[model samples]
Target: MEPDGDIEIFLVASPGLESVLCEEALARGFRDPTVIKGGVTIRGGWPEVWRANLELRGASRILARVAEFRAFHLAQLDKRARKVDWGAILRPDVPVRVEAACKGSRIYHAGAAAQRIETAIREELGAPISDDAEVQVKVRIDDDLCTISVDTSGESLHKRNHKEAVNKAPIRETLASLFLRRCGYDGGEPVVDPMCGSGTFVIEAAEIAAGLNPGRSRRFAFELLAGFDEAAWAAMRGAGGEGVDPAQITFRFYGSDRDAGAIAMSRANAERAGIAGLTEFRQHSISDLVPPDGPPGLVICNPPYGNRVGDKNSLYPLYGAFGRTLLSRFAGWRVGMVTSERGLAAATGLPFAPPTAPISHGGVRIMLFTTEALA
Candidate 1:
C-alpha cells in the first residue's frame, strides 16, 4: 500500500487442489511458491502480479497484498487504514468493493470491519465504494492482525472469453489445465477428451502445446489500477514472442461427445480460441472413440457423476464401457479423469495410481484419477 518494492501475491486455487497449483506455479518459474490452505503465496511487485494473472493457468484469481497491520478494534483499524496509500494502487475514478472476513480477532464483525475500510477509502482516498465493482479490496482480520489485498484478476481466469457455449456441468478451463498437468501432460503429444462437454480439455491442451497464455484474450482488473503502464504491459505480453504457430503444431487435439450440441459447442470454442486448425471435434459416442492418426498421448475427461448429472446407479455401466474401450484400443496412452465417487472410478478398472487431493468444483468434491501409459 505504501508503494513498497515487493508485495505478497497469493494465487488462489480450487479448495483442495493447492498442491497441484503450487506445482504449476513452480514449473511456470515463480520462485519458491509456498502453499497455504487456499492458495500459493509468493513475493513480488506489480509485474509479478500481472504475469501471474496472465500466465498462470491453474490460478482461479490473483490477490496482491497491499497493506497489513495489527488492529484490535474497529476505530484503530479505521485510523490505520486511513494512513494506507490507497492512491498508489487504486484510482479515484474506478469504484471498488470491499469484502471483509474476521477470524480470531477482537473486531469480530466482518460488516463493521468492511465499513471502517470503506469509510477510510471513501473519505481519505476519495474513491467511491460500491456493492458491484470490478475492483475488489479484501480485508482479512485474523488473530488481531488485518491484511488488505486487491483482487488483480477481474473475472475468474477460467473465463478466457473463448467459450460462449457451455455444458450443464462443465469442467472449468483452469481446473482442466491443472488436471492435464497432473497427468504429466506438457504439450508434447496428442490429447483427447472422449466425453468432451465443451472442449475444455482439448482446448487447454492445444493452448499449452501452442504456448499460449490463458489470459491472452481477456482483460484483468490490474489494468484499472493506478499507474498502470499500458506500453509496459503490451511489452510484457509479447516478451516471450507469439505462441507456437499452428503450422508448427503437428500434434492434433481431438474431442468428441455423443451429443451433437456439445460437438458444435466444442468446435465453436476451438474456433474462438484460434486453435481449430489444430483441433478436431466430432459427434460420436464413446464406443466410437479411438486414437487419432498419430503417436499415443493422453486421454482425459470429466465424465458425468450423480451429483451433477444422471443417477449414480446409472453411471457405473458408462464408466465400465469407457474403461473397456480404452483397454481395448488405447494401449500406451495415459488417462486422466475427474469423478466424484471412488466407486465409479473403480468401475473403470483402469489401474489409476493414487488420486490427487480432492478438488472443489461447483458444489461437490471430485478427484483427478490418473494412470501412467497403459500397458
Candidate 2:
C-alpha cells in the first residue's frame, strides 16, 4: 500500500470494550469511526494516525491498515507482498518486526507467511527485520485475504510515559479510562479511588479533567515512518494542550491507599503527569476512606480479589467493611468497584446495577460494579 492516500486506522480496544473505545474516538472528532469486532476503524491520512496515537486515551495501540489483497496460496502471497510499496511507509534505517496470523486461509502457515513478508521488507525496503524492533508490521490472512498493518504506537498507550512507579497488579491506564467512561465520568465531576494502588484511576481522572492528552509525553513508532511530518504533529499536540487550563480546574481527584509507598508513588506519578495540583494522594485504608470536602462525586476502586492477594474467606470482612463505610459516611456518592470474584462483589452488599460485560485484566476476567448515589 502506498502512503500517499487515505489510510484505514484501527484503534485496538480491550476485548468487550470496543464500543467504549468507539465512543471516545467519535467524541475526539475522528471521521466516521465504525465499531468492529476487535476494535474501531476510521479512515484518514498520516496526520490522523499521529493524532490518534497522541490524543486517544482508551486505545491500547493504533494500527494503520496499509494494504489488503487476495492471496490464495503462499506463492500468491509472496508475489503480492513483494509488490507492496513498503518504502512509502517504512524507513530503511529503522528496524521492523513482521508478525502474521492465519485463520481458515488456504495459506495457513503463519511462520512461513511471516518469513515471506520479512524477506520482502528486507530485500525490497532495505529495512532491517528484528524480533525486538519497535516498529511492527502485522499480517492477518483470513479466508485467503491478506491485510497488512503497521503498529503506530511503539508502546501500549497505557504506559503514558510519565507513570514510572507502579504498585503490584496496577490497572492499566487504558482500561482505567474506559472504566471511568463506563461509569459515566466526564471531566466535570471529581473522582476518588479508595484502594488506589499506584493511583491509575485517580491520575487518569486528573488528566482527563485537566484536558491533558494521554500521549503528550511519549514518542510513537509512526515518528520513524517515511511519511512522518514532525511539524504537523507538533501543531496538533499544541492545539490539544491549549484546550484546558489545569490551574483553572476546580474539582480535585483523590486517591488513598493503606501502603505509604503506594501513596508516595501515586504522588510522584501525578507530579510527573502535570496533574499533581489537581489531585490528592493520602495513605489510608478502605475503612478510613472519606469523601473530601466537596459535592457528591464518583468513588471508583480496583480492589484485590482472593486469587490475587489474599484468601476469599479473609477478604469477605474487608468487602463488608468497605460497603459499611460507604453506606454510613458517603451519602450521595456513587461507587464503582472492579473485582474478579462475584462472591467478593456480592459481599459488599452495595446495590450495584447489573455488572458491565466482564473485562480481562491482569489475566483474570473482571467486571465493574457500579451503584447509584447512596441514600
Candidate 3:
C-alpha cells in the first residue's frame, strides 16, 4: 500500500477479458489504462486497489507492487533483494509462498533464483516459508530486470465463494462481467439472457443494480501482511456493507434456459448471491422468449457454439429460429449476441455490426455483434 510514488496495480483476467479490463479501469477512475497480453496495468494506490477488488467483476486477482530492482545474476539479485526492508511488507509470523519465473535473462535457473530470494526473506527478514502459505510473493525476471509483486488477493477473485452449481459450458464470472460491460450494461436498464447458463450474467446485473460490491464477502491475503491497516480495512468493509437496498433495484433482469436443470441451478446461484428476488429464471427455449413487461430493453446472450454441441451445421437452424423470433416478436429492443463462429452469428439473419473487439473465453475466441436496427 505504497502511497507516495506511482504504484502498479495488476488486474488478472481470463484469456479474452482484456478489453473489459481496460473498461473496468476507466470506470473505476483510472486514467488511460493500457492492456497487456493477459492483464491490465494501471497506476494507483491502496484505495484504488480496494475499489478495484470490491467493484470489478472482470478481474481475477488484484496485485500491488511492493518492490522492484535490476539484477543480472544470483549475486546481484542477492545484494538488491537484501537491501529492501522486507519486514515492512511481510510479517515475521505469517507464512509465505514464493514463486518466480525467468525469461530471456542471464539468471536462467528459476529454482536457484527463487531459492536465493527465499533465503533473503527467511534468514534476513525472519519470515517463515512454507508450501501451504496464505500470503504469496511473486517474482518475475524479464531480461535481467526483476519486478516483485505482492499478491493482495490470496485466492482467485472469480471464486467469489458462492457458486457451487455450474452449467455444462458455464461462463466464468469475470468473463460475464466483461461481456456485460462491452454490451453497455449500466445497471439502470432491463437485461435479458435468453440462454442464461447458471445465471451468471443475470446475477451480476442484479448485483450491479443493487450496488453490491462483488468482493465484499471474500477474504484477501493482504490481511496477513505486516502493518496491515485492519481498522481502515474494517471501516472500508463496513462502509461497503452499508447503503445496501434489499428491494431497491433499479432494473429487472431475466434469464431463461432450455435445460430445466440449468434453470434450477441458476435459481439457486441467484439466491446464493442474494439476488434471487430480483432475478427471474425460467425453463424455456429461445423460441419461446417474449419481451418482459417493460419498455424496450437490452437482450444479451451467449449462445452455444460448436465447441460443446455436435456439428456446427446442425445448430444453424436453431440460430436461425432464434433470429427469426427476435426479428418478428421483439422489435425496438437492442440485441447483443456473443459467439465464436462467424457463421453461427450469420445464421441469425438479422443484420448486425461486427464486434468492436475480440475476447478469449474458455480457450475459445468470441466476439460480440449488436443489431444496428433495433426496430
Candidate number with greatest lDDT: 1
- lDDT of candidate model 1 versus the reference: 0.91
Q: Give the Cα error of residue 311 in candidate 1, in Å.
A: 0.6
Candidate 3 regions with alpha-carbon error over 4 angstroms: 1-6, 15-19, 30-34, 242-250, 308-310, 356-358
Evaluate model 2: give its lDDT.
0.90
Which ranges of candidate 2 are over 4 A from the true structure?
Answer: 1-4, 308-310
Predict model 3's lDDT versus the native.
Answer: 0.82
Q: What TM-score does structure 2 among the candidates reach?
A: 0.97
**Residue 271 in candidate 1, Cα distance off native in Å:** 0.5
Candidate 1 C-alpha lDDT tens digits along 1-375: 332368889999988778889998888888779999998998887888999998999999999999999999989999999999999989999999999999998999999999999999999989999999999999999999999999999999999999999987999999998889888899999999999999999999999999989988899999999978889899989885668888887889999999999999999999999888989998988888888887999999999989845588899999999999999999999999999999999999899998877777888799999998998
Q: What TM-score, over all chains together, does every model reach?
A: 0.97, 0.97, 0.91
Question: In candidate 3, what residue range of length 10 has the lowest lDDT sum?
Answer: 242-251
Candidate 3 lDDT over residue span 92-167, tens digit each? 9999888899999999888888888888899888998998898988899998899888888888888776678999
